[model samples]
Target: MSETMTIAPEQKAATGNSNKMLFAMVGIGLMCALLIVLTYEGTKPIIAKNKAAALEQAIFKVLPGTMTTAGYYWDGNAFSPLKGTEAEGQRVYAGFSESGTLTGFALPAVGLGYAGEIRVLYGYDPAQEALVGFYVLESKETPGLGDKIEKDPAFLANFEALSVAVGTDGNSLKNEITYAKSGEKQNAWEVDGITGATISSKAVTEALSTSTAEWVPRLYEAKERFKPQTQSHE
Candidate 1:
C-alpha cells in the first residue's frame, strides 16, 4: 500500500514566509540599482566639466605664455583643427600667445611608476629641440616621496630645456632622456631624480623619453603646418 506525502501546516507557513522574504530582497536590490544609475546620470555632466577645466589649466601651466589654446588632430600626415569626436592616437594641443603666436606644444605622456601609471603634460619647443616645461597630471605614487616629482625644483628644472635633438639618421632622437642619481645630472637630456623617490622620478624620465621619441620627429616634420595666425587679441 502506498501512502501520500503531505507538508505540515507549519512547514507550508514557513515556505510562504521564505518566498515573501526572497521577493522583498529582490525588489530592494532592483531599487538600489536604479538609484545608482540615476545618481551617476545626474553627476556625469558635472564630472566632465570639472575634468575639462582641470585639463585646460594643466595645458596652460605646462606651456608657458599660453594665453589660449587650439585643439589639433594629427592624422599621421598633417595637423588640422580638431573637429567632431577625437580619434584614437590623434591628440595634440597647440598653445597660442595673446598675440596668437604659437607658443609650444603641450603633449600628454604616461608611464609605469613604482605604484602604478603616471601621467604628465609636457611642453615641447620645436625650435629649441627641447622639452621646455612639465606638469604631473596624475600619479599613484607614494605621498611626500614620489609626489616630489611635482614640487622638486631641482628635478623640475630638467624639463626647462631637456634636449631631444634628432639623430644622424634624421628620424630618431639622438639621445633618450634619462634620470640620473640625485645631484648627478650631467647632460641636457638627463633628469635629476628626487632624493627619495628614485622610481617615480625615473618614471617621469622614461615617459618623456618614450613620448618625445615618437612625437618630436613627427612634429618637426609637420612644423610648417602649425604656423601662428598673427591675429592680435584686443
Candidate 2:
C-alpha cells in the first residue's frame, strides 16, 4: 500500500490560523470602509448647514445694512436666482435692507499671497462706485507677517470706501486699486500696504482689482435686475 500523505498536526493548525487571520484582516478593512462611508453620509447635511450659516453671516458682515440676502448666478448675461447648484461663472449674493431695498453685493475674490492664496469677501456699492466693506474669508499667510492683512486696523480702513469708479469707457475701472507706501495714500482707490506684509496686502488689492474689472461693469449694467421688488403703485 502507498504511504498515506499527512499534514503534521501543527502545520495544519498554523495554516488554519493564517487563513483565519487573513479573513479577519479583510473583514476589518471592509468594516472600516463601511463606517467611513456611513459617517460621511450622516454628517454631510450638518456640515452643509454650518457652511451656509457661516456664509450668510459673512454676507451680512461684509455688506453692512443687509438684513436679508439672496444668492444669484451670473451666466455672462444676467443674474438669476440660483437654481439647484448652478453657481457657475460669477456668483453674487445680494444684500437687502430691512425695508427690502437692495443694499450692496458681496463678491468673492482670491489672489496669491506670500504663502498661498488669500480669499476675501468684499461689499460693492454700485451706486457709490466704491468698495464699502471687506472681510478676509480665508488665508494661508505667514503667521505674524502676512496675517496682518486681516488684523491691521490701518489696512482694514482701506476698504471702508475704496473707489472703483468705472472709467470713461464704462467697462473698466478708472483706476485699479494700488498699494501705496505707508502713509502715502493719495487717492480713493489707493490702499496703504501693511509695513511688514506688503505681499499679503498687495494680494488683496490685486484680487479686488481683477474681480471688479470683470464684474463691476456687468453688475452695473444689470443694476435694475438687482432692485427689490416693489408693489405696483397703480
Candidate 3:
C-alpha cells in the first residue's frame, strides 16, 4: 500500500454534506421531542385540577348545597384529609354545606352489567331520605339498548326521589327494587323496567341499591363528622 490514500473530490464533498445534514436533523428532532414532553408535563396538573373542580361543581349542582373543600372527603374515607391523616391514605371524599348540615353525598359505586363494570354516582337527599338523582360514571353496555338507562329521560326520571326504604328486617328494601313485569308501581323503590333491557335495568337497580341503599344509613351515623367551625353573628 502507498504511504497515504487519496480522497475523491466528489465523494469527499458528498460525505461532508451528508454528515452535516444528519447531525442537524438529529438535533432538531431531539429539541422537538423535549419540547413536547415538557409541555405535557407542565399541563398535567392543570388538567387534573380542572377535572376535579368540574366534577365537584357537578356534584353540588345535583345535590343541594354550597360547599368548601373543608367539609369534603376523598377516596372512600368518611371525611377529608384532616390533621394527622396521611396524604396517601385510603381516599374518601364527603361533602357538607356551610351551615354544618348533612345535605347529601357523592358516592361512587360499581356493579356488574350485561356488558361489563357499571360505575355510577348516586345523589342522596338526606332531608327526604331518598335518592334525588344519579349519574352513570361509566359502563360497557350495548349501545341503544342496555346503555339507555344512563341517558333516556324517561328512565332517568323514574329514579328521582326513589327512596330505598329500609324494611323492618333491615336486609331488604322497604319495597324490593323490582321491575313491574305486569303491574303498576305501588312503591317508589320500583320502576317500569327498561321495556326491553332487563339486564341493564337490573344493573342500574343493583348499582343504586348497593351505592345509595347502604350509604344513606352510614351517612347518618357519620353526620357530625363534617360539622364546621361556626362562629356566626347573632
Candidate 4:
C-alpha cells in the first residue's frame, strides 16, 4: 500500500499552461464580442441617417420635378402618413413639386440579378399610366457587363415614359414588360437590353413587371391619397 500517486513537474506545468491559454482565449473572445457590440451601437444612428438621406435623394431622382417628398404606408383600405416608427404593409414615397402638386410616386422594388439582388426605385405617373423615371438603389451585378444596366444611356432611356397601363380589369398590366436585344426595342413596354448584359437587363424588366403589376393598380386607386395635403416628413 506504499506507492504515492504523483503528477510529474513537467506534466503539472503543461496542464497549468493549457488552462492559462484557455482562459486567455476566452477573455479575448469576450472582449472582441463586446467591442463589436459597442461599435455597432455607436454607428447605428449614423448609418440610419445616411440611409435616409440616400433614399431621399433617390426619391427625387426617380421623380423629376419633385421638390419635396413624403412617405406613406398602405393600410388595407388606404395610405396613411408614415409618422410612427412602426407600420404594416408596403411603404411608398410621393414626390411633390414646388407648387405642392403630386408629381409621381416612387415605388421601391427588388429582384434577383446576375450576381445578386438588385434594389430599385421606379417613378410612376398614374395620369400617363407610364413609368416616368428609374433609379437603381442597390445592385451587385458584374462590373463591366451587368453594371451597364445602371449607366448605359440607351438602357436608361427605356424607363422614360415606358408604358405600364393597367388592363381593362384595372388590376393588371395591359402589357407585361418585355426585354429585347440591344437596338431591337419596337414597343412602348419593351426594355432594351444591354449589348453584353442580357441577364441584368431582363432582371430589371421583370422586376418592373412584377412590381408594377402589384403596385401600379394599388397606387392608381390610392392616387388621391398622395395629394398636396398628405404631409411630408423630414
Best candidate according to lDDT? 4
Q: Among all windows of ten consecutive residues in candidate 3, which has the lowest summed lDDT? A: 84-93
State in Å the error of residue 215, model 1: 0.2
lDDT agreement with native, every candidate: 0.82, 0.84, 0.64, 0.85
Give a tens-digit lDDT track for model 3, residues 94-200: 55677656566666667798989887766766567676767887899999898887887777877677776555755444654556542466677776567667788
lDDT of 4 at 233: 58
**Which portions of model 2 miss their true places by more than 4 Å?**
1-38, 84-89, 227-234
Return the TM-score for candidate 2, rounded to 2 decimals. Answer: 0.81
Residue 37 alpha-carbon offset, candidate 3, angstroms? 6.7
Candidate order (TM-score): 2, 4, 1, 3
Residues 63-136 of candidate 4: C-alpha lDDT, one tens digit per residue: 88988888887776778777647432277888889998889899888879998888888999887889999999
lDDT at 55, model 4: 82
For model 2, residues 143-171, the per-residue Cα lDDT tens digits are 99999988899999999899988888878
Candidate achieving the largest TM-score:
2
For candidate 1, lDDT tens digit of each residue in 4-76?
5974656533455877898999999999999999999999989867866777788888888888776677776
- Determine which window of 10 residues in candidate 1 has minimal summed lDDT: 225-234
Clashing pairs in 1: none
**How many residue pairs in model 1 have overlapping backbones?**
0
Q: lDDT of candidate 4 vs native?
A: 0.85
Which of the two candidates, 1 or 3, achieves a greater lDDT against the reference?
Answer: 1
